[model samples]
Target: MANLNLTQNGNFSSLAPIIPAAGDDNGRSTLIFLGTGCSSAVPNAMCLIQPSDPPCAVCSQSLFVPPEKNPNYRCNTSLLIDYCQSDANRSYILIDVGKTFREQVLRWFTLYKIPRVDSIVLTHEHADAVLGLDDIRAVQPFSPSNDIDPTPIYLTEFAMESLAVKFPYLVQKKLKEGQEVRRVAQLEWKIIEGNHEKSFVASGLKFVPLPVIHGEDYICLGFLFGEKCRVAYISDVSRFPASIEYVISKDGVGQVDLLILDTLYKTGSHNVHLCLPQTLEALKRIRPKQALLIGMTHQFDHHKDNEFLAEWSKREGIQVQLAHDGLRVPIDL
Candidate 1:
């Protein structure tokens, strides 16, 4: 999301109608939901339920409408954090470059006129999270400064190792003798040890990585952005570590301006994702001023999920809602 006002465009306008005011003299940051679906995304290829099935109506409807028009028609989960440093320069930091990265980038360029991404941060090394790294070459030409400097990618050492094995060309620094140079994405890797106490700065923003359990063997990171507008985003997690709970607490109460969490389905725990009950429990612990749920599966119907969450939020007196693709939230930084 950019500071400029987002007007009604295609189908996204119908999903998120309230666009925040732009042009505040104070620094501003916007969190744009590039995609909000889980690994398989909405209308999963294997799930071709008929109209009689539970989520068939929503899934079928999403199939006909293009992603540009319907926020419910999701790709893979990813987010864009845009910081307006000044009226002249805007920097974009992307979280996760999933299989839909190219499509997401093209859509943003058409919708927000985003020239380039300043950096990237990976939550883990899951295929759905890092499969789109090769698409960065398409974005390279749009660099605002047009400098040859490689774009920085921040991740844990394990993630870096996984990337090295999968995309050796992009991570390699030298070309073999007699090997002709070809256009490819150039990236500089920054290893993050996932120490919650240690905060790191990138692209003029401070971030703390909260290490949490993804499953029995994997460790996923939930990021806490420390600035004027505090935001914590945990897109994929099965459980929160005790240290993360302490960090998000203020005195005795939870504190955060906006919390983006993982909610894979309405109920029942998955091996590597949080269920609705788990998400609700985390919400109670985090107690953010506003909360949005992501990593949804085809089981969730956009209209039904929102309607249910809206009523639940009202009853619980919390500003919790289901996030859709293309949703944008502005923060004063």
Candidate 2:
């Protein structure tokens, strides 16, 4: 029943009765935040090169401090779902390998000792989401000599089409009969139907897709996963269709233990991503036990805004806050 039974010095607090204690270890898993910034990334390069008068306070602080030390320093929006099997095995299912994916892997994955990526799910074909598909090779091979099976990547057909034009080799491997497989990433693209809310299995775990509007006519997917505990994730989006809203609501089809959604700015609306006002509204409507806002830009001052969100959480009776890179929340499956 707990949304977050967490770590990293209690950044995650339990909202609903603590998952009936540790005795019930049925579907245990850990949700790790690989990165939590928007496409440009926190401390935008332009902000660093072309300075503002006083300089953006948040961007200013992002420098000279590692993201581990400062939550303000973000790479890209990504989450790693580490599912522990009842048989003592574990699988790593990564969501959205963005442009900063390499940086995230070197930073958090190394620190967390994430051995390998078993599967990958792309939110969309945006550069920030799928450009790092090439870098998957560095983490895939268990041995340097032999060629392994291509890692399964689940994505929408539109995204797959985009990748076909952008990264053709990754989709259809151009290997000669005797050629080696050590150059690029070995990948198998699996299309996820975006027209309807369908449940797909990645690594022995079921994931229900929640489709929402990205820009105007384009649709991006959010996912609903978990057995013992339900979790909903919508990383990049502007608005949800009526069907999406109801599907995620408690009275609709199901409920969420943890809701991870997108928020790009502190106040105004964005053409592609959700702003704070709309994010809060969605939280109110979806009514998850707890929520974490992701895909933030420099306009968001982590410490300052988190303080405000803390108060908002208190008043609204929902434990929602800004999710930072390196955030690890242990959750029930």
Candidate 3:
């Protein structure tokens, strides 16, 4: 393990190269943070405040600093789960292909050299989460062996219907007698009932969808990936149900190894997203071994936020931190 260093600019000084452990190297998995911003993303064009009007220093600094220097200057929220088989073959499971999907995917390829995405699991059908569906064409022919086989996509029926309406070309593939075939994103849609009554398997991975309320009328899914690596990702949650609490906790004790939660604002509440106060209350209940806050807005300054969280964690004796783009956490499988 390398010493973790925080730089003055509020980003990790350096990311240690991921190396497979010696012996007992059957398989390994890693969680990659592709983006950690809210729907409008950090440094939102409309929210840019100048220096004189009680300005937002975070967003203001983002205007001048390069993205390589500030990891908090983020796109929309999304995650990449990278799994390496014993044979050294690599596969990826993506969560939420957002508006910045193409940029994030290209960054992943340039930074980590990942070549293919095995599957995509959508959290909901919100534009910020699903608008990137068309960009999958960049990685067409997902599998090396089968060019025609579409990449598997797992989501709720509601989301499936939404995609069918939004991207008809990708969802419904048809041919005409005299028409030439057009190349589009090939996708295999799998519908999972997200009532929290059942679990689904995708590419040998088991996922339990924990239904959460996303405002007044919409329902969102927070997934729990089962196996040696226990992770619960609830990025757009406003309410956490008791049923999900039972699934993630062991006898009222938190058993989730990692809890990736949504904390969209520094303060105050929103009808659809979790604010800091609400997130802290939920954190106290979940009691996860480690928690990473995501779905942030430009109001959050990485340095300032971590400084507050560091003191809070010291007083509370719980390990929690804010997530940033390009951050990666390795999981033993």
For all predictions, the C-alpha RMSD in Å is 4.6, 3.0, 4.1
Model 3 lDDT per residue over 180-293, tens place: 567777889999999666888776677889899888678899999846657889999888778777777644634786789999999999999999889988877777766789
Minimum summed lDDT over a 10-residue window in model 1 is located at: 10-19
lDDT accuracy of residue 318 in candidate 3: 52
Collision pairs in model 1: 11-69
**How many residue pairs clash in each candidate at the backbone level?**
1, 2, 0
RMSD in angstroms between candidate 3 and the native structure over all alpha carbons:
4.1
Q: After superposition, how far is residue 293 of candidate 1 from its true place, in Å?
A: 0.7
Local error of candidate 3 at residue 163 (angstroms) = 0.9
lDDT of 2 by residue, 198-248 (tens): 778998778888888999878898888888888889998998899888877
In order of appearance, the predictions have TM-scores of: 0.88, 0.91, 0.88
What TM-score should be assigned to candidate 2? 0.91
Model 2 segments more than 4 A misplaced: 1-27, 142-146, 174-182
Cα shift from native, residue 159, model 2 (Å): 1.3
